[model samples]
Target: MIGWRLSGALVASGVLLALWWLWGANARLSDDLAAERAARLAAERSAVLARRVAEDEARAQLQGERLNVELKRAAIGRSDPVPDYLLDHLRGLGVVQ
Candidate 1:
């Protein structure tokens, strides 16, 4: 009877040990899955930010080009002959006397 009790106790201990090992492996796998999900989320966020930055840069470039074209047009359309009143003011200031 004592031998039977000892054997039963050993079997229970072995089962408990196996359960503990399985629980530890499951916890490790859960941690790895969480880390992988976090990494994927970060990569997705980075891609969105990169796309936004590229769009902003393109818009800025287009605006800059439009402004440059407007400046060129204004420069080309400028009249060279000064107004008479402005010429008289310059003569009064002795700048064109």
Candidate 2:
């Protein structure tokens, strides 16, 4: 009878110890997961910011190209001859006949 009681107590203590260890491990794993999630969010934000900057730079480049085209047109003066396509269209309408 005494042996039975002693064995029961030993089994209960082992079960309690196992539960405590499992709880600690779970808490540690949760902390690590939270840290990883935070790092990912930060990285994503940086990537988004980089993309916005790239888009802005591309828009600026397009604007510069348009300015250069306008400058070239101005340098050529407004005395340029009319396009042949325009003359054909006007002749078709009898305006240039």
Candidate 3:
């Protein structure tokens, strides 16, 4: 009778050990899957941010060029003859008084 009980106990312990090993393997697989998903998401987010930054830089460059062109046009329009600054002209206008 004691020999039969010892055999039963050994069988139960073997089954428990197998279950523990399976559980550990499953947990490791789940962790690996989660880590892979996180990496994929991070890569996608980085790609989108890089593209947006490139687009923003291009837009800023275009705006700068437009502003430069406008400034050049304004300067050209203001390129007229200079006013006379003689003392006689100031005296006639009563500015020297």
Report, for every candidate in turn, its global Cα lDDT versus the true structure. 0.80, 0.80, 0.76
What is the Cα-based lDDT of residue 30 in candidate 3? Answer: 100
The 10 consecutive residues of candidate 1 with the worst lDDT sum are: 66-75
Q: Across residues 6-97, which tens digit of lDDT does each residue of candidate 1 receive?
A: 99999999999999999999999999999999999999999999999999989977876664465456447753545568657755755443
How good is model 3 by TM-score?
Answer: 0.71
Q: Tell me how many residue pairs clash in candidate 1.
A: 0
Error of 1 at 66 (Å): 1.2
Which is superior by lDDT, 1 or 3?
Answer: 1
After superposition, candidate 3 runs with Cα above 4 Å error: 78-97
Model 3 global lDDT (CA atoms, 0 to 1): 0.76
What's model 1's lDDT at 92?
A: 79
**What is the alpha-carbon lDDT of model 2 when measured against the actual structure?**
0.80
lDDT (Cα) of model 1 = 0.80
Per-residue alpha-carbon lDDT of candidate 3 for residues 1-97, written as tens digits (9 for 90 to 100):
9999999999999999999999999999999999999999999999999999999989977876664565456547754432345435644754332
Query: Which pairs, if any, clash in model 3?
Result: none
Query: What is the C-alpha lDDT profile of model 2 across 1-97, one tens digit per residue?
Result: 9999999999999999999999999999999999999999999999999999999989977876664465456447744555668657755855444
